[model samples]
Target: MHLHCYSWTGAGDDLRREGERRPPLPPGDLAAFRASPLPPMRTCDWLLKPATRIDTSPPTVTEAQTWLADRYGTAEPSFLHPADEARIGLDLRLKIAEESLAGGTDVLWGIWLKAGGFICLVVVCCSPNRHADYPCPCRLTSP
Candidate 1:
């Protein structure tokens, strides 16, 4: 698998400046991320935000299906099934509310996987107010 690392200041101006001034991160830098506990500091202002992209090796459609089925216990994961979309949306709303109550921004992570003509998108949001819990994979789960 290959991973890409980048950061966003959560502002439009910073994003535009980043596109104009910064080059892509070195592949070795991403490798270092997996081996080291602390990531290197960003040299530019726009590259200091929190975000990342992970790209896995291409897999066959059947492989993707099997992986999802194993991870979620169903061929159709909740994120992929239309019937569960509303529930996901509501969960995000509640998460945002909880974050607001805790004096933190509503931090959300989006995962997009594509391989062998199959695509899956997952959005996991963390609420700053919540304590550590196994079922919640948000970064703020721990104090």
Candidate 2:
């Protein structure tokens, strides 16, 4: 079995492609930032849709990150270049999660399970403080 927690932009770019860190907004730019249209968090519905079952209850963000860290052997995951396939692991997950809570792209988190090289299950988690434009799917009783 292969397991990992992955994070990506809703637009489907590699996590490392977040480009340069965003600069601090000037006082006058506050209005622009406020007026900017932010999309609802990308729930990674593609992963959720085909499930025979989905466990809405997910581990906490720290728990999820730790899971990856333990498995990948990285105690402190710093933002670095993505692997050849653009797969996201602990580092990108942490960065995206932080950016999401700070009013950037609505990042989503999920635990991915693969067995025999085939994806088998996914567990979606609620965003930090439930800061989502839509209801928290993770809190749903049913898929």
Q: Which candidate should be chosen as best, given TM-score against the real structure?
A: 2
lDDT of 2 at 95: 65
Task: Show where candidate 2 strays beyond 4 Å.
Answer: 1-52, 67-89, 101-143
Give the candidate number with the greatest lDDT: 2
- lDDT computed for candidate 1: 0.28
lDDT by residue for model 1 over 42-122, one digit each (tens)? 322112223333222113323332332343333234233445544555446444534442342222322222221122222
lDDT of 2 by residue, 1-143 (tens): 11124332222232223222221233222322222222112333322221222323334544544544443443123223325214665577666654443442333333222221111122243343232232333334443
Model 2, position 17, has a per-residue lDDT of 33
Name model 1 segments beyond 4 Å from true: 1-31, 34-79, 90-102, 110-143
The weakest ten consecutive residues by lDDT in model 1 span 1-10
* Alpha-carbon lDDT, every model: 0.28, 0.32
**TM-scores for every predicted model:** 0.22, 0.28
